[model samples]
Target: MTQQELQARYEAVMMNAFGAPKRVFERGEGIHLWDADGRRYLDLLSGLAVTGLGHAHPGVTAAITAQLGSLGHVSNFFASQPQVRLAERLAALTGHPDARVFFTNSGTEANEAAFKLTRLTGRTKVIAMEGAFHGRTMGALALTANPKYREPFEPLPGEVVFVPFGDEAALRAAADERTAAILIETVQGENGVVPVPDGFLAASRRIADEVGALLWIDEVQTGLGRCGEYLAHQADGVSADLITLAKGLGNGFPVGACIATGRAASLLQPGQHGTTFGGNPVAAAAGNAVLDALEGGVLENARATGAWLAWAIEALGHPRIEGVRGRGMLLGVVLTRDVAAQVADAALKAGYVINAPRPGVLRLAPPLIATPEDLAGFVEALPGLLDAHG
Candidate 1:
């Protein structure tokens, strides 16, 4: 069917919460995507950083195909080899060998699982950072501080205190014995790619320890080599009691996990939390393939490309650019003016794709496998795109 016809059908059939579709994508290969009209654009955002291995990655496809041919899913009642292997790999990569994982199908579900884990600690208050975006689920929403998103759903799970994103003092002052957990995003993706200040996460660990609260870092957007590391928190040199991951875990195959470490791992017993589609064989195989490819040159490529992008952005010499923030492949271009949305739209018109999380912030999280040449091409086009906004 035509793009317009499909869009109409979507509006009729699907819920309106997400608004209209951006463009009807017919196909994708590597970093390029084609709309139904055959217009192609570079996928810089990588489907909001979920497609870490890029579109149609051979390894991911092969793993899914092989797993589906054998045993696709048996629900959480029956355990599968791929599921167990993926959990083991995640626990190892998380740097806590004793960590246990609870799988879900999306990042929100992972956060929900972790949310419940906090409850098992016999505390209810959670300290969340301002400008945080955990997810839209009720439990995740409680931890999310934005009023525009949370105000609509009032009387939510209460006792969530919001502190400034990078202020260690405010966070410290807000914490006490009543706090169950302190949740943070290593790099705030939806808040326009804001990274926690240096020493901020470590201080959080100290505070959590002092107050007897669990430190929970949400790596749903920055994990799985998205920021040139297995988990972004690893770069901070701080171990979190609970870590939630999803976006890049399965290379867009739809999987999430809540890994709990130390005493936190013992919080959730069997039947306390479960997901029907979590840890399915097909999703686990896809996750394993992503982990396999994350090794070797793929991770190095992400680091190099990310570094190159940051340097190029800084070198753009555009008077309108306030600064560049974030680490590795996850970056936010802070415009001096509130022109991020216009700049992103201009980029799409120029055969590139990017996302504007806020009016002044343009976020870019290209595939980890993006080539240096592709990086250069985007860099070369960026100045022109920003100028077009002028």
Candidate 2:
């Protein structure tokens, strides 16, 4: 019943993969969460950018209820209306009407599917950006460049190269005819919410084309209106051969998709890949509800409120606060010192929930529905919080 009790039980049974639980969240609504102790906190992380529609969203709940009451899941052997409709919606959103969708249950699985799709290009090498975090699975892990995450799992899938995140020349040098795909994150979310350098994406596209490699953009954290756009790469006017999505796709519902466009759409053949519960009706319905909410002013609010939050943070001009980086709701508050962990802990005590993805970077991905008032409160509290920790 209490946070400590739940934490004890969790540690006794759970795998300890994520360390100790921060708090036992009992319930949430909009951008707020209540722990088991009945303490309330402003949730700025949005469950690591998954809850775009926020907790217990009425539209998302209603869609899930209706779909479950009607037809929940029918396996991949048979198609369901919601599943087919969601696929069409994703294809259209990709700016490639004829793009094919391969559904998965999580972002990692989506990246796994994309990894396999790359192999179908008759090439073996995959060039991924440095400081990239694709996923944890074996195939996706190979593409992830973090040494800490990859060292434990030795002899991972081979022929994977890592290049500087925003270096066009490095990418050009790494890519070649043998490169099956060039995987990149439009904005490196796990790498402190860093945005891709200007012109880097377009340059990557051109280089990939010259090398006959598929350009794969990982939009798991920046897609579905999280970064003020459907796909962050779209703002750069660069189209990818394969785009992997997940985090905000189902608004907290477990769902992901690998969208393949142009000739790459036909790469994966029948029996080559399969999923037991990838595009079930329930997840599809939830995905549709998230899209509905995004279309209905949530996206515009993200753009407006995000700009306001960035401006407010900059206006503080605190000595410890370096600057704010990122687009839309996905932001990272940079600090002059590597005390982000202390700041985040202090923020928790001050009734706020944020994350220090790096030693000096605090990542903020509040719900898309968060208002300017909510962000203003965080900005106002941030200075004192940093001072206390610093």
Candidate 3:
């Protein structure tokens, strides 16, 4: 079917939550996608930073198929090998082998679980960063600071506070003995790939400790090697009581995990929280496959290629280009003018996929497996593309 036909069908049936469809992509491989019209485009957004292993990776496909053929899902009542193994893998990766895992189906659910876990600390107050995007759910939505996203859904959960991102003094002023948890994104992905100011995370840790609150790090977009590290907060040499993950964990598979470490692991007792399909074998197998791919040099490739891309984009010194923000593959191309949406649309016409998360910020989260050559092509084309659209 044609892209227009598919779009018309989608608009007629699906909710208009995401506005009109951009294009009907039929298939993808590596860092490339083919629309219904058979035109190819390099995908730099990685399905909003979920497809870390790229599209249709052989190992992930094989793992999911094998698991489905054997034992797809057994619910949370029964123990599944893949589920247990993936939990162990995540525990180890978090630098806390004893950390407990609560698997969910999406990043929003993971954050929800963490939100509940924080309540178990005998405190109702939670402090989140400004410009944060936790999720659309009621509990997560309360922590999200965007007025547009929160205003429509009033009467959200109460006692949630928002402070300036990376402002140690603001955080300190907002946090107190009543604060149950201090939630933060190591790198504010939804806020234009903005990394926390250096030493800010460590300070938050100290503040959380002082107030007897849990330090929750939301790594939904920056974890699982997306930022050239297993967890972005690792660079700060501080560990969080709760770490929420999704996005790249399952390499496009619908899976998320809320990991609780130290004393926070035991907060949610039996029957307090659960999911029927959270740790099903299929998703767990896919998660394992992603971990395997990352261990097999994908992480190193991200570091190398990401640095190259950042340097190349900055080296261009294009008149419209302001600078680059973010670490590793999670980058935001800041523009001098508020034409990010125009640039993104022009990029689509030029056979590329990117996103304008903010008015003047173009977010790029190419697959971790993307090569320097692939990025170089985007770099070479971006200057001219910006000139045409900027």
Best lDDT goes to which candidate? 3
Models, CA RMSD each? 1.1, 0.8, 0.8
lDDT of 2 by residue, 130-235 (tens): 9999999999999998899999998999699999999988999888889999998988888898999999999999999998999999999999989988887898
Query: How high is each candidate's TM-score?
Result: 0.98, 0.99, 0.99
Model 2: lowest-lDDT 10 consecutive positions: 371-380
Q: Report the lDDT tens digits of candidate 3 across residue range 206-297.
A: 99999999999999999998999998899889999999999898888999999999999988998999998898999999999999889889
True lDDT of residue 69, candidate 1 = 100
| Overall lDDT per candidate, in order of appearance | 0.91, 0.92, 0.93
How much is the lDDT of residue 343 in candidate 3?
A: 92
Error of 3 at 202 (Å): 0.5
Scored by lDDT, model 3 comes in at: 0.93
Query: Which TM-score value belongs to model 2?
Result: 0.99
Error of 3 at 111 (Å): 0.2
Q: RMSD in angstroms, candidate 2?
A: 0.8
Regarding lDDT, does 1 or 2 come out ahead?
Answer: 2
